[model samples]
Target chain A: MAAPASFLFKGKFLPLVLLLPQLIITGVFFFWPAFQAVYQSFLREDAFGLSSQFVGFENFTDVLSDPTWLQSFGRTIFFSTAVAGLALSVALFLAVQADKQIRASTTFKTMLIWPYAVAPAVAAVLWLFMFHPNIGLFGRMLNAAGIPWDYKLNGDQAMLLVIIASAWKQVSYNFIFFLAGLQAIPRSVLEAAAIDGAKPMRRFWTVVFPLLSPTAFFLLVVNLTYAFFDTFGVIHSITQGGPGKATETLIYRVYTDGVMNLNLGTSAAQSVILMIMVIALTMVQFRFIERKVHY
Target chain B: MLEKRSLWPYLWLGIGVLIFAFPIYITVIGSTHDISTIGRGDVPLLPGGHGVENYSAAWAGGAGRFTTTPAAVMLVNSLLMAVLIAAGKIAISLTSAYAVVFFRFPFRMLAFWLIFITLMLPVEVRIIPTFQVMVNLDMTNSMAGLVVPLIASATATLLFRQFFLTIPPEYVEAAKIDGAGPMRFFKDVVLPLSVTNIAALFVILFIYGWNQYLWPLLIVNDRSLETIVVGLTKMIGTGDAQNEWNVIMATAVMALLPPVAVVVLMQRWFIKGLVETEK
Candidate 1:
C-alpha cells in the first residue's frame, strides 16, 4: 500500500518524533543483532571467547559440510512436512464438517479453536504427560501391548511425539482459516456442481478444492514457517534435541550448538541461513497476497 | 452447504470435537486426581477429591522434582508481560502508522521498511546474538528484557497502516477546517474510529505475548520473572515418574486459562484481527 498523497498533516518534527520509538526498538533489537549475526558468522572465536580471526566463508562451509547439521536439515524437512500435512488435512476435514449446517457449530468452533491459545511448550508438556513411558496411560498401554514407546530413549518415538504435539496445537489455527475459506465460497457454485450430478467427494475435488487453493497455499507457507521456527519450544521442552539428536530441527540445532555447546561461529552461520529462509518465505507470502489482491 | 437433515455432519462434528477435547479433558481430570492414581498408570476419567489441594499446592509453589517456583508469581509475570507487549506494540504502531499515513516526511518509507524487515528476524533465528545483546545491555533477568524487544511489531504496524489509509480524507479536511491540530485530531477522531481494530488486535497480541516461550526461557533466568508458559514446562523438568504430575497438570490448566478466555470471550474480535492481520 502506498502512502496517502492528497490530505496530509504538515509537521516535520512531530512525525519523526512519532516514528522514533518503533524505529529505535527495531534498530536496537532487530537490525543490530541481525548485523551482529552476519558479522560473527564470518569470524572464528577461540574456546575461551578470547581472540578471534577472520574466517571468511569457512564457518558456513563447515556448517554446510557437517553431517550432523545435514541430518538436522533433513529431519527438519520431514518434521515440517509431517506437521503441515497432518494439520492442514485434519483441519480441512473438521472445517468442512463445521461449515455444514450442524448443531452447535459455534460450540464446536470454540472447542477446536481454544487449543490455538495453548503454548507450544505447554502443548509439549501435555503430550509428554500422556505419552511418558513409565507413568503415561498410553505409554504403559503400548508397552503392555508388546511395543516399547519411550520417547526419551528412542529417537524415532521422540520425533513422532513432537510431531503430534506440534501438529495438534497447529490444527486449531488452520481450522479457522480453512473454515473462513470454505465459507467464502458461494453456495451457487456448490449448488451448480450438485445439479450437475457430482457427488460430494467429487464436487469437493473438482470445485471447492480449487477455490480453496489460495487459502491452502497460504496456510502451507505459514505452517512451514511455524514448523521451522515456532516449534522451538516444543523441541526444547519435550525433546531438547535428545536421544542422540534425532529430534533436532534446524532451529534446535542452532540453540544446541550456540547456547549449549558454545559453538558461536557455526551457530551464527546457521542463524544467517535461517534468516535467509524466513526472508524468502515472507517474500513469497507477500507476492502471493499481492496476486490475490489483483484477483 | 445444503445438507440440513443429514446426521453425517453431526457425527463428524461429534468426533472432531471429541478429539479436540480429549487432551484438555484428560489434563483437567488428571489435575483433579491424586498423584498416585496417575502415577500408577491408571487413567482416571472421573474427578477426584484432590482438585483443590493440587491447585492450591501448584499456585503457592510449583511441585516439580528438580526446580520449583511459585505459580502465582509466574502467572502474574505472564499477565504483565502480555499486557505490556500488547499495549507497547499498539501504542508505538498507532503513532508510527499515524505518522506515516497522515504526515509527510522524508525517510518515511525508510522507517516503514525498517519496521517491516523485522518480520524476517524472528527471535528463534537470532537467539544467540540477541541473547548476547541482552547480556551486553544488562537487560537479562529483567522484565524489560522480556517485553521490550518483542514490542516492535511489523504485522501490527502494517495492519494499522492499512486501516488508517482507509480513513476518509473528508474527515481530515473537516478537522483541519475546524483548526484541530494533529494530536487533537488523533485523540478526537482517529482513536475512536479505531477502537474495534484496537480491541481485536489486543486479543491477538495478548495471546501472542502470553504464549511466548523461547525468549522468556532464554533471557529470564530469575525464577520470579519466569512466564507461566515457560515455567510450566520447567515444572515438568525431565518428565519422570518422580515429578508431580497432578501439580503440573494443574499448572497447565492455569496457564491456558487466560488466553483461552480472552479468545473465547472476544471470539468475534479475535477472528477479525487474525483474519485481517494475516492478510
Candidate 2:
C-alpha cells in the first residue's frame, strides 16, 4: 500500500518506513560497532585499530588480574561517585535557592552556569593553571591567606582538584534539572504546610522533596553516566593519570592503551569493560532505583 | 516565614557561585600573565604581555590552528551538520510521535523500547565498531562521515515522543473529522505545540555537536576535518615545546563561543521544556 504513497498515508507500515533510515543508521553505527568492540576485546591488535590473534579470554584475564587495571577501575568508581554526589548536592542546593525567586537569582544563574559552555579542555587548563604552585591564582591566593596548597605533586590534592573542578562544572546542569523539579511542586501543597505552622525547612523536606524524587533519580542516572565516560577530556588534560596514576580512571586507561601505547586490542578490551559497567549501571538505575521515584 | 526560611539557602548559592566562577576568573587573569611569571605562579590584578605571545605559539604549536586550520573549518562543517541533525531529528521524531500517539501503530511498544535502548548504548559504547563501519562505508572524513550516522539521535526521538504525548489527541481527532489528513493535521495542529521541544533539541544538539572531541579526533586524522574542540585540544594537549600559557588560553577562549551562545540564548526556552519532560 505504501509503494505508491507520496504525501500521506494511514497504513500500518507508514511509520515504520519513516523510522527505517534512523533505525538502520542505529544498527550500523551503534549496535554493529558495539558487537565489534566486544569481539575485538578478545583479540589482539598489531597496528592502530587493526588486528588479528584470538587468545580467547587472555586479554580479559590479563585486564582483570592486573593491579593497575584494578586501580584504574577503582579510581573511576571513586571519581565518578565523588563528582556526581558533590555536584548533585551542590546543584540541588542552588536549585532550591533559585526556585525561591530571589531578586538577584537570575543574574547568579546566568553567570554561575557560564562555565558549562567552556570546553573541558579549557576547563582542564583553567584548573591546572589556577592551582599551579608557583604562579597560579589559587597559589597566590593561598600565599595571601597563609594556607598551603599545591596541585602539582600531592596525589590526594590532585584528586581533590579534579573532583572539585568536575563538581563545579556539573553544578549548573544539576541545578537546571532540580529547579525544574522544584517548580513542578504544587504551590497549594506548600501553602498547606505553611498554614499548618510547619517551618520552611520542614515544608521542603516533607512536602517538596518527595515530589522531587523522580527528578533526583533522573539526574542521578544522567550525572553518573556522564561522570563515567565524558570525563575523558578532563582526565587527559588535568592529570594524564598522573602524579603517578593517582587520577587514572578506566577511560584514561582506554585512551592510553588505544592511542598512546597503540595497544588497540587491550584498549578495545578496556573499552568493552567500560561499556559493560555503564550498561549494567544504567539498567540497575532504571529497573530497581527508578521505581522508587515518586510523582 | 517561607521567605525568611529560604534565606540561608540563597547565601549558600552565593557561596556556590563564587566557588564555580572563581576558577574561570582566575584563568582569565592567569592567561594574561607571563609564562615565566606563570611558571613562577604569580597572581596579578592586571595581565602581562604574555597573552598575545602565547597565542602565537598555541596557533603554531603542534596542535595549533595553523597546523590544523581545517579543524576550525570543521567547526563550520560541524555547525552545518548540527543544523541538519537538529532539523532531521525534529522531522523524524515528530512524524513518529504523531503516528504512535494519534494514530495506532503496530509494534509501538517495541519501537519505544528500541529507541530507548539507543540512549542506553551511547555513541561511546559503540564507537569502536562504528569506526569499522565508517571505514567500510568510505565515510571516514567526508561530510557524510560527520552527519549521516549521527542523524539518528535516540534522545531527541524520545524527548519528542514524550512531548508529543502531552499534546491533546482531541485536536487530531477533530482534524480527522474535518477531512484533514495526518500530514495536514500534524502541520496545522501538532507542530504549533512543539516549539519549545524543537528549540531545546536544537540547542542541545548544537552543543553536543560542537563539544564532540574523541570521535572526530579518532576517526578524522586530517586536521582540516577537525572541529573547534579537536583544534583546541591539540593546541593545548601537545607535549611539544614548553606550552605557551597565554596563547593556549586565548585560543581556548575563542573556541568557547558557539556553545556559550547556545546556552545563553536557548536557556530561556529550555526551562519551559524541562517541565514538559518532567511531566
Candidate 3:
C-alpha cells in the first residue's frame, strides 16, 4: 500500500514518544553492531582486543586468500544450491500431489506442515539419531547391508547428512508456498489445455509450469537465503563442520572464528561479506523479482 | 478438473507423508526405549515399556554428562523467552506502526528504514560485534540479553502498518467526534479490532522465539538458562559413550513438542500470519 496520507495527527512530540522504544532498540541492537562490524572488518586486533591497528582490506584479503576460507566459500555455495534444489523439488512434488486430492487434503497439509515447527537444531538431532553409527536404525541397517555409513568419519557422508537434515526442515515451508501458488492458478486454463488435446504432462510443462515460475523464483531466493544463514543451527548440531572441515559453510566459519577461535577481524570481515550478500539478495528480491511476480 | 485421476495422488502423498513422519516416529519410539536396547544397536520400531522411566529421568535430571540442566528448566526458559519475545515484539511493533501510519513525524521514513534494515542483518551475520556489544553492556547470561536484541522486528511492524492502513478513516473521525483522545482511541478501538492479528502474530512469533538456537547459544552461557533446542544439542556429546541416546531422544521430543503443538493447534492463524507477513 502507498504511504498513508498525513491527514489528521498534529502532535509531533507524541509520535516520537510512541516510536521511542523501537528506535532505541534498533539503534542499540541493530545499527550499532552493524556499524561496529563494518569498522572491525578493517582493523586487526590482538587476542584480547587490548591492542588494535587498522589494516585496510587486509582482513578481507586474508579471508579471501585463505584456502580454508575459500574452500568454505565454495562449500557454502554448493550446500545452498543443493539444499534449495532438493527442498524446492520435493515440496513442489508433494504440493502437486496434495493439490490434486480432494479428500483429506487438510489432513495431509497438517501432517506435512508440523515439521516446520521443528527447530533446525532439533531437526539435525532427529536425523542424527536416525543415522547414528552405533545406535541408529538406518546406520545399523546400512552397515548390515554391507555399505559402511558413518557420517562421523566420512566427509562426503557428513555433507550429505547436513544437507538432508537442513532440507528436511525446509520442505514444509516451501510446501506451503508451492501449494498456495498452485491453488492460486486458474482451473479453466488447465481445462482449456485439455480441450486442446494436451496430455497431463504436456499441459503441466507448457501451461502450469510457466505460470508457476514466479512462485518458483521467489522460493529460490528465500530458500537460498535460508540455506545460507538460517541453517547454522543445522550445521552446528549435525557435524559441527567436522570430518576435517568438509561440512563447514560460511556462516559456521563466522561462528567458529569469532566465538571459538577469537579472531575478531577475520570474523568481522566474514560478517561484512555475509551482510553484503544478504542485502544484495534482499534488494534483488524487492527490486527485480517482486515486480515480475504475477500477483 | 479435466483429467481422470487414479490412486496415484494418494500413493504419492502417502509416500511423502511417510517420509516426513518416519523420522519423528522413530524419535518418539526411540525415546520410549531404554539405553541398553538402543546401545545394543537393536533399535525397535515399536514403543517400549520404558517410556515413563526415560521421560521422567530426562525431565527431572538432564540427559548426559555435559547436560547439567534438567529438561524442565530448559523448557521453562524456552517458554519464558518465547512469551516475552512475542509480547515484547507485539507491544513495540504496534506502537511504532501506529506512529508511522497515523502521525506525520520528522524522520518517519528514516525510522522505518532503520527497522527494515535489521531484517537483512540477521544475528548470524553480525555475531561478533553483537556479542561484543552484549558483553560490553554486561548483558551476557541474562534473559534481557536473550530477548531484547531479537525483538526489533520489521515484519511485525509492517504487518501492523498494513492492518492499520485498512482501518476505515471514518473510525478515527468518529472517535475524534466523540472527543476520544488519541490514546483513548488507540486503546479502545484499535486494540480491540487488532485482536485477531495480534493472536496470529503471537502464534508465529512464539514459535520463532522458542525455535531460536544460535542467539541463545551465543548469549546465554548459563546452563540453567539453556533453551531446550540448544540443550538437546549439548546433551548429545561428540562421542557415543558420553551421549545417552534414549534420554537425548526423549529430550528431543520434549524440545519439539511446544512449538509443534502451537503450530498444529493454531494451524490456521499460524499459516495466515506466515503467508501474509512474507507478502
Which candidate number has the best TM-score? 1
Q: Give per-residue CA lDDT, model 2, range B146-196, as digits (tens).
A: 777776766677677777666655565666678987767677877888776
Tell me the spans in candidate 2 whose CA falls farther than 4 Å from its real position. A1-9, A44-56, A140-153, A186-211, A262-265, A288-295, B5-10, B30-40, B47-78, B98-109, B173-180, B238-241, B273-279
- Say which prediction, candidate 2 or candidate 3, comes out ahead on lDDT: 3
Clashing pairs in 1: none
Backbone collisions counted per model: 0, 10, 0
- Enumerate residue pairs that collide in model 2: A33-B129, A134-B40, A134-B41, A135-B40, A135-B41, A135-B42, A136-B41, B54-B247, B55-B247, B70-B224
Local error of candidate 3 at residue A47 (angstroms): 4.8
Give the local distance difference test score of model 3. 0.90
TM-score list, all predictions? 0.98, 0.84, 0.97
Chain B alone, TM-score, model 3: 0.96
Off by over 4 Å in 1: A1-6, B63-67
For candidate 3, list the clashing residue pairs, or say none: none
Compose the digit string of candidate 3's lDDT tens values, residues A120-184.
98999999988988888898899999999999899999999999999999999999999999899
Give residue B207's error in model 1 in angstroms.
Answer: 0.5
Candidate that would win on lDDT: 1
Best by DockQ: 3
Which regions of candidate 3 fall more than 4 Å away from where they truly are?
Answer: A1-7, A289-295, B63-67, B239-242
DockQ-wise, the better of 1 and 2 is 1
Give the true-structure RMSD of model 2: 4.5
Q: Can you write out model 1's per-residue Cα lDDT over B1-279, one digit (the tens) per residue?
A: 455478887888788878777888889999999888988888788889999989988998954443468789999999999999999999999999999889888998899999998998999999999999999999999999999999999999999999998998878888988999899999999999999999999999999999998899899999989899998888777677878889889999999999999999999999999999898
